[model samples]
Target: MSGTTLLINLAGSIALLLWGTHMISSALLRGFGTQLRQWLGQNLTNRWMALACGIGITGVLQSSTAVSLMATSFTAAGTLSLAPALAVMLGANIGSTLVVQLLSFDISIVTPLVLLVGFIVFRLRDDSRFESLGCALIGLGLMLLALRMLGATLGDVEGSAIFQLLMRSLDGELLLALLVATVLAWVCHSSVAVVLLIASLAGAGLLSPSTSMALVLGVNIGGALPSLVNAGSSVARRLPLGNFLVRLSGVLMLLPWVPLLAQPQLLGQLPPALLVVGVHSAFSLVLALLFIGLTAPLAALLTRLLPEPERVVDPGMPLYLDESGLEVANIGLANAAREALRMADMLSSMLSRVLQLLRTSEQANADEVRRIDQSLDLLSAAIRAYLADIGKEGISDQDADRSQEILMFVINLEHAGDILSTSLAQLAARRLRRGEHFSAFELGTLYPLHREVLESLSLAVTVFLREDLPTAHQLVNRKEVVRRLEAMASREHFRTLREDKSAWAESGDIFQRLLRDYRRVHHHIAALAYPALERAGERDINGGLVGDGLADAPDTIDRKEPEQCAS
Candidate 1:
């Protein structure tokens, strides 16, 4: 064959190989990413089991790189822990070796047959996954068939004088042989291809068995380049994964004599391809066994060394909703999601308490308010972190909607806490500075109403959680009455504010603060009514279904001049 023809075939074969690998990887990801994540998270009840699962998963996938990348993505998203990911990384190493072994077999004899069948299925698009899978198989078959042709092409040129001269220089220098092999394999992003090239060269008599085996060592070392480089750019805890690569590859090459047994006479009779696969897998497994047990100590060290990574507010944490973590058990999956929701609720509750504390005139109250505000902020941060984790998990459409809604609700709750703490609390403080307290009669009129309004809000939340349609319906009817009563109480207080200018000057700020907070809390409660209605399959309460019963509501709070004091 001409040089041009050889080059074209090689390029075409290489492209098809890369493309096929990509398609298969994506299908595996799309079909199983979330299930995979959930399984990793909740299913790894023990370290040994985690290691086993990791190995099994990676072995099945045929790409340790894929497993590592998936684990890195999960760690960054906050869904996966460093230990579990490390466990998978170990398994992935073993899994990746499986690919080389498969390639080593004489599957090429049947390659054309598989390719023919694959093409027939590929054209059938009704089952898109099947079609994709068919195309992938065809691509694989073509790459294999290309290897045979390339093997023949090289064999034709092997006994030539020029080839003999070239072989003399490369044969003796193991490092040189290793370097060339590494570069070529790195270029292809495939150690399997590297091993194939080695096998073909040895088979064609282009290179001696010893030299070909030396190149296999280089192939394994080269495999680490992509993953090691990627690890540098990964999250802090995942640096160890890259470290695993550097250690594995470096150790194998440094101690090659023990493992490679790279003798030309020995290499000549053995299946060089199978040797490549075995050595590569064993090298990784050795590394995993040596290091996987050290996962916890390593994690602790990384934590101690790296410090806490700075978190940003933008692209929130990815939940373990991806295919990696979710394959364990259905109950475990639901538990993780619900825990995320519960965290959100806890944040909302804590934030509410902080806001309530902020609404005070006493200096003592102010101190407590500030402390609670800081606590609320911390809770918000924690909830946000948990949300990032849940986002990484595989979610059903309904779960996705619920997850987003819960996140949004927490954000709103956080802001509400901020407003109350900063604005309402300050007003309360200023009123107390004047030494006036809630008037006895004013308390009598407003306190019971406030209690009743809060009780109603409590009832609404309970009904929503329980999915009680009747209770929700009844709560809808009472909201109007609560609004009327709130308005009436506001008037009675306003009348008191009007009666005594001196009193207004003294406690005006406190009175206004209380009224504003009372109204704002009521508004939040009112807003929750809709969610309750939604739970019950009712129309939006804010829409016409509730009618104009509360239509005369003051769009804005009435800030009119005070009148005669009722108190």
Candidate 2:
């Protein structure tokens, strides 16, 4: 074949290899992502277990970059500590080398059978797990086929004068070869692909063993770039940065030894392809052994270097919504949920102060409540935008439902904050302006009702997170308790008004408004239980239909009676 044809064939084969790797990663993540994440999360008690967990996950995912992202997110969320996270990165490096080892052998004979089975399973299966498995098998077949094609294409150009000259020039210029390979790996975003291509070129006599070893070192360094580039917060970036440093250190330590190790006497009977793969494997193994025990110290150093930035005092800015998490559906959903919980917390703060504000009628308390409501508004908008950016592609049906649940929860919290800030705070301020105070009987009735709403807000948060059936039933039950409290308070107010018209008449309207606002706030808090109950196929909670009884309207507080309040 001509030189142009050979280059084109080589490019096509490399592209196919990259595509196959992507197929395996994406398919496995879609099928078993939650399981894998749980496994990784639950096993990080120590360095050894974390190291083993990383190896197993990276091997299954077929891409260390994916594993790196997972580890980074765990650390960023404060779920996993820095030491174990670094150890996982070390194991991920070794796991990637194992993939290269498996592909280095001649397994081309099984390629066709694998492809046939994969196509049948993928096309015929209705189950999503089966489809993901079949898709992964097909990717495996494509990888095998691409490697075979890559070797054959390089073989045809092995005898070309121009190829021979280029190989000869790289033989003496180890640094130049290393630089070239680093660029290739970084641009391709897969060290496995770049290393496989190098092994093929060495197998075809287009690269010397020493030059191939140098390229392998560079590939390791380049593999760490994508995670570093894509990381969002300093906490997220630390793992990738530490992984990069480890690879860079190994390269510097191994660069001088590459030529010595690749000498004919030392290389003995090993084929060039196996020799190149061995160098990659040995480098990773050495790094793992050296750095595994030092992870804690390294983590401390990294913490000092990448100190968490000073937090701004603005409560409006989102703390948990990391933009980088959006690339993974599960991570993005977790981020949105955490932000929703933050909104819930802010609403709780506003509610807790309501009774105090009403009792004291202080301007300071009212101002603080309004400020928290404004913060809730800002956080609600941020979370909505973040969920929208998570998008529909690659997200499972369950995750899409979860995204909606979070959005609904956030909307309700925002509505509750509005009631606290505008209606309740204004009523408190009006009482202060008119020098009106709740009588002993009025405070007695209002205190219990306010307390019930606070306890229900706590239950709402629990129901939102766990979606526990029993908890959902409990939360829905409280809705009835709140209704009875509101009705009793109304009856007592009328009784007081009739018994002493002048003493109660002036403040009676404000007191009644306070009772209605508290009930409305409880309704919004109780709305969280509806989705959980609906999912459990329990349409009725205490004789009330799920998602009924309340207005169910976003941000609207109806002034209707308790009977009409059933949404």
Candidate 3:
């Protein structure tokens, strides 16, 4: 092949490597992002666990940059402490070299077989996760095939004058060589690809071991660029910045010794490709060992540098809805889910305050109810706007369903807030203004029903967060219990009005209105569970009929009540 053709082939091989790495990373995230995130959260009790989590997660993702982004996002959300996050980065750096180590071996023979199996699995599987797993397998196969092709192309020029001239030029200028490799890595958005390319070149005798080692140093530093540039918040930037600094320090410490270590008689006894891979792995391990102890102080410095900004009171802003995440569907959906959770929290506060207002006559409590009501309105509006801006083109059909679920869930909560604030708040205020004291029997009837509604609201929020099907079905059943309580309470109130006018004069109107509104609130809360129930096919979403899947389903209760008590 001509020099130009060989060069083109090499370039194509590099692109292939990058494409393969992207496939692996994106697939891993789509398949296991939530589970990995939960595992990381559960294990990050200390620096050591954090380090282990980072290593294990990065090894699975096959991309340290992805792990860094995950850590940085958690830090920004305040779900993770900075010190442990920094430790995770240290371990992630070490985990990234595993790809290089695997690629250095002679696994090219299995490429076709892997690709065949991947294609079959992808073609046969209907689930997104399974399909994504197939995609990952295909990507790995492509990477191996690209490595073989790259090696063949580079070997063709082993004795050429151009190759000799290029090597001679890079032989003395190690820093210049490092710059080239670093730029390549940054542009590719993958240090694994860059390291693999350098190893292939070294194995083919197109580049010496010393040159490859210098390039590996560049790869380490360049690997951090993507995370740093992508981080929109200071909290997100701190973890990646700390990671880069650790790598920079390690590189500086090893710079003077590169030449000494590169001498064939000293440390080059292994094959050229193996030496390059070994050096990359050793450098990462060194970074982890040297910096693990200093993570706390390092985190402190980072915290001092990027101190959490005083939270601005933007009631209209969506706290977790990051626009940058919209480019990646899973991440954007996760952000939307978190924002939905925040809304649920506000709704929970509103419910608690409503319950408080029912039991107390404090002016401060009434004011808090009004204040939280307004906040809920602002938060709900912000959530809708945030969801509107998220593009649907990239997300899977399942994610589209999730987005709809969040939208509907938030809308239900907002409606429930309006009920509590407008209807329930008004009745409570009227009762307090009248200076009325309820009889012991009346108070007894209201308290139990109120507590049950509160419990349903809490459980509904749980169903929203967890999508627990069994609990969702139970929540639907609880809706029936609430209906009975409302009916019974209304019937007792009417009997009191007929039999004991003096007692009725004190709390009758307020008590009736409160029961009606509380039942309305329960209806809204129970509505949140219907989506889950519908997804499980336990209920027909449109007709409100229970599905045949239930072997011993409860008989559907008639929910109609007396006209005066109707919500």
Candidate 4:
């Protein structure tokens, strides 16, 4: 009867644990996903911040593996930089320790209360904040309840002859236990689950201390292996996986060095289960501390494992992600996507400047513009090729989608750059052919307007990146200013044509051509503004343009929505 009772409890606990964790993890992921992507785009200020974000994500999700895989895939996609991804992976190792800490404590008492409160909120909207809160609470409650039940069941079955024989059967065969643990972790697709199993067995005194330690080691190593396999051909991804294994190496080595299964620390004060988890997490912390200062050097080595990037290695990641960046776990993909986005931003900014230069017609300025244009082309081609190479690994569906979007965005902007690059020299030639061109006042109106349009471009890219709805809305008013100013200038030109028609009768063809060229330049600037404004979701900026048969556009941006104001 006791054996049957224990079996029932174990089954129930496992079911509850899995369900709760699933619920909470889903909620936390949804709540933070876009913001996480934003952070990935920005890539935290430095390595430490990346690590902290990784830890925070794993702590909330209760799964280090999830964070690591996400970061790794992002690295492959060229979204996140390699170094920050590695740093975050390191922090994820720390955050996953929280689960062990929780399981060590007595949490069964409040499980019922948590479930009751959580159920009350779960009925809310699927994406509502309250619904997410309920999911987290319920998941926590269920996991705690499971741990309590497992402890009770194990305590009841502790003295079973069958159990004792089975555990003692593996006595000194630590290698076998490690292999078993690794296989179990891979099969279950969760190291945390394996940890729980080992914890329960140890608590029942069914497994010896050395065997339990080996099991812990196996669980850690196995948890990271799947992602490594998934990385396939991505050097950026492989580097971080290598870093994780190397960090795990310290723990693996330490286990064999640990003394006496019968000692006080091993069995008397610290139970086998506590020792198992404590050893794994403690060693991770130690490894991080040991290697924290060595990050730059380690990063260089890991990065060296990959193909050399086209750009020179500066603190800036013009080419690839650092391995230290992806080690944190699930945050990998988002961070990598962000890096790709940043490169795209730089390219867009360069294109805008090229357009501004085209509006001017000086020989020196034209030459400078040519150099900048070549640089933009080289960088854009490099980034696009980089994203393509990175995407071959098993990146997540979302990240793959993001890659496609980013590629499309950059390609369109690149076309615009190409347009401007060739036009500048021609504009300069036309001015020289016409001989000093117009009055100083005419150049003043034209040049200042061109500069302002280019200056305004800085704001549009800022709005797209920041997702600032208010700023995006402000762009509409600014566009209006551009429109009226452009109209006023055209009117002034027509007046010049009427009043000075006789003086420039021979330059008649130049007048019409110049007017058409200038108007087209303004039209391109106005076109760039639509993407930023539409992303804000304020008004259909391009709906009017589209209705007038200008361009085919999507109703919503793939990853953004500005509720109330903007994210």
Q: Is candidate 2 or candidate 4 better by TM-score?
A: 2
Best by TM-score: 2
Alpha carbon lDDT of each predicted model: 0.56, 0.80, 0.75, 0.60
Q: What's the residue-level lDDT of 180 in candidate 3?
A: 74
Residues 1-567 of candidate 3: C-alpha lDDT, one tens digit per residue: 798897798788767765776677677667755565566567786788888878887776556766776677767766578888998888888888885666556766688988898888888868877898899889877766765666666566555787557755786578988887777677656677677767767777777777878888988989888778888978788988898899889989997788889887977677888888888899999888888899999989998998777876755467777555666777787887887777677766776676566656765666777777788778788777766666544566777778788888888888888888888877787787677645556666766566666677778878988999877877777777777777877887798789875664546777888888888888888888877776777665464747423223223323332222111
How far is 299's C-alpha from truth in model 3 (Å)?
A: 2.4
* CA lDDT, candidate 4, residue 485: 56
TM-score of 2: 0.57
**Overall local distance difference test of candidate 1:** 0.56
CA deviation > 4 Å runs, candidate 2? 1-34, 41-85, 108-164, 203-209, 262-265, 268-274, 308-348, 351-422, 425-567
TM-score of each: 0.54, 0.57, 0.52, 0.45
| lDDT of the structure predicted as candidate 2 | 0.80
lDDT of 4 by residue, 1-567 (tens): 467876677678656655666666567555554455556778664878887888887765556766776677666656567767777777887777776676566656667988898888877666567777787778767765665665565556555777567667866787777776776565444566568777878886777777777777777777777567656664646645665566567656766664464466645368677776776688668766766566667666777776645745432334444332343322443444465455445444544443334344455545554555566566567556656655644577655655564555455455545555576345545555456455544544455345544545555556545646555555445555555555566676677778875655544444434444544544454444455444445345435432222222223222221121110
Clashes of each: 44, 5, 0, 33
Query: Once model 2 is optimally superposed onto the true structure by TM-score, how far is the C-alpha of residue 358 displaced, in angstroms?
Result: 8.1
Least well predicted 10-residue stretch by lDDT in candidate 1 = 558-567
Segments in model 3 whose C-alpha atoms lie over 4 Å from true places: 1-34, 46-82, 109-164, 196-212, 262-265, 268-274, 308-567
Ranking by TM-score: 2, 1, 3, 4
Per-residue lDDT for 164 in model 3? 59
